[model samples]
Target: MTKCEISIKMMNSTTPSPSLGYLTAHQLENLVKEHHRSGWKSLHMEEAFHLFNKMLTAKPKPSIFTFNLLLIAISRMRNKQHYPTLLSFFNQMHQAGGINTDTHTYNILIDCCCRMNQVNMGFCVFSGMLKRGWSPNTVTFNTLIRGLCSKVDITDAIHLFEIMPKVGCTPNLITYNTLIKGLCDSQNTSLALEWHKKMVAQGIQLKPDLITYSTIIDGLCKEGATEKALELVQEMIDKRIAPNVFTYNTIINGFCRKGDIQSAFKLFEEMNEISITPDIVTFNTIINGCCKVGSFDKVSQTFKEMLARGLTPSVFTYSSMIDALCKGGAMDKAYEIFQQMVDTGIEPDSITYTSLIHGHSILGQWKKAFELFKEMVDRGLAPNTITYTAIMSSLCKEGKSSEVI
Candidate 1:
């Protein structure tokens, strides 16, 4: 039989094929429902496909909802490599021609398409949904908008946002948040603010949520409008929205980038006051900020506090501390920290080695610097241009220019 003939036979088959194993449509649905309820973990792809084949050849075919459940499970697999497997299975179901596709089915397809970087295919699926007389819901619009945004097609995303109301679907908080993120990601924060204003003015009882505020704040911070971002944080609190750790981190990072370590510390204290524990990222940002300002004392204090709070120092934490000590002309202390980092099994990067080498070279300790360079190479870490320049410059300054070659 040809492919079409086999599909027709599969669609029309009443009795379950013995080769596919016997399972009633209702039993297969229960299996799928259980898998869905368990967070899509109980069913493997092969087992799901086996059940699907059994359902197809059963006396009564399963409902589209059941099929959608299986497809959702496949789509949501943690390993995204299963996305194409889902698309292929969807094609097989479509070719069989027994069950009609629904809006949820198309939405799943659209999401898979977008995730696969096939945004154009997602739009095609959207168009097909429309042609099938399926009214595109808010979820449909949100998914498409996100797809357009992921491709950096902000203009089209904005156009779609404008027409959402025309399709009898009002934009919700998710819709507003998605569009705002898109605008911000495209470096158009000014337009994002306008959308924020319009969302507030709509008076549809639709208020900007934490995500809405955070996205705009992050955009402003990226633009060096950190003071404005801080004002937004106040607005969030005034509106009875508690700023989470992520919100605080974004603002703190902004202050650090601006060299406003004092302001960053103030926010760090505020987080403690609000019962929001400062995470490792919070400590790292503060330590790095102190390093930049040459406030080695503050770095030491903060590093101790971070340990007191039971947070393990990351590689960045050690590197920043080591670099700061080296710059402070405290070679012994820097070496002590380096040894501590090694004892803790935190492998040093080229930055760490370069900092120590540069510090030793500054003191005209060329032998120690050379030993460090050799050790760095033995560790399979390549010395960068900064490393070479530090050694060569020190040799020239010591009137040992001949040894530089």
Candidate 2:
């Protein structure tokens, strides 16, 4: 009774794969979860849906396990910009009595709703789940807390956080991390620190993770408490909590913004000594600092070092180099790098083009400047107000405004 012709077309699905009919429902469910658990970009949501649909063609249609698997796949859908279809699927499953809606099912649904910023709908689901005598777990609380924090509803998030213990669900590390990050983002680092202390005092967080420390360090650094951030870094190191690229990048960026490039470089060197390979962000940060300090040689060396480590530089990297070269009055060198950037398939953005155009205009190279300006426009990049003013000023001074008309 299997219908090969019965195909469900998902218009918004990024990877529209065929319904996998080869595997059993259990195997299909396992594969779907494996894909979801692998990483953010690993799961193909459309294919998972298709597999679930494919399962319906057989006897003993997908159990709650398979139902939850489809839900999990939908929750981790990468193309969040697409219209939400998970709720529709949930409703279909619920109406058809295909499977029993358990605590896990509601948890997934609530998490998905919350992630979509539809926290009210998620709460409705929670109320329904509770009415059915299902006990909500820490994940249920964490999902809502995290969602509220995302919407800058720190007060509600805190209210929920405080009531977790009262509701028979203890606060986990994720609970604290979410609130701490929310407070830090609201620039209320003092209160975040208080919670951090409370988390430690509870003795539950005896072995805090990188996020726990990094969140506090990020807040301290933003508050111009770089010294305090450094102390936390040392504490993290002492506790053997290895700082990831993001953790180091945060502190390095803070130093660079504070105009303390020397300290940034020192931190960069420390990262190497600690066997933490620098990421693209790390190199980009240092490159930016080098540009500000007019250390062109160091900038070039860093670029080479980045390549030597098998890391491809970003569009920002090439753009920054071109800007630095232009600022140094080396227009020919800037043009060379710009060409190289294009050859590497890195199209220059408005800022990069403006840097080159302004440099050429300053040196009375009107033809070259105009060409760069035209190229920027032809590429569909609308010139900003500053870019237009700078280029117009150059052309008007050269009595070439008429030429534009």
Clashes of each: 0, 0
lDDT digits (tens) for residues 1-405 of candidate 2: 111221223333344445454666667667656765765365455555566555544355657776776677666664454225676666666555656789899898888777777777778878878998999999999998888888888888899988898989988888889889999998988898889888778784444678889998898888878878888889888878888888888898888778788899899999999888899999998998788777888888888999999988888988888887777789889889888888988878998998888887777777778888898999998888767776787788889987664
Model 2 TM-score relative to the real fold: 0.81
Question: Tens-digit lDDT track for model 1 on 264-331?
Answer: 99999999999999999999999998998888889989999999999999989999988888878899
Q: Judged by lDDT, which candidate is best?
A: 1
The alpha-carbon deviation from the true structure for residue 376 of candidate 1, after best TM-score superposition, in angstroms, is 4.2
Cα-based lDDT at residue 74, candidate 2: 66
lDDT of 1: 0.85
Using all chains and alpha carbons, the TM-scores for the candidates as numbered come to: 0.86, 0.81
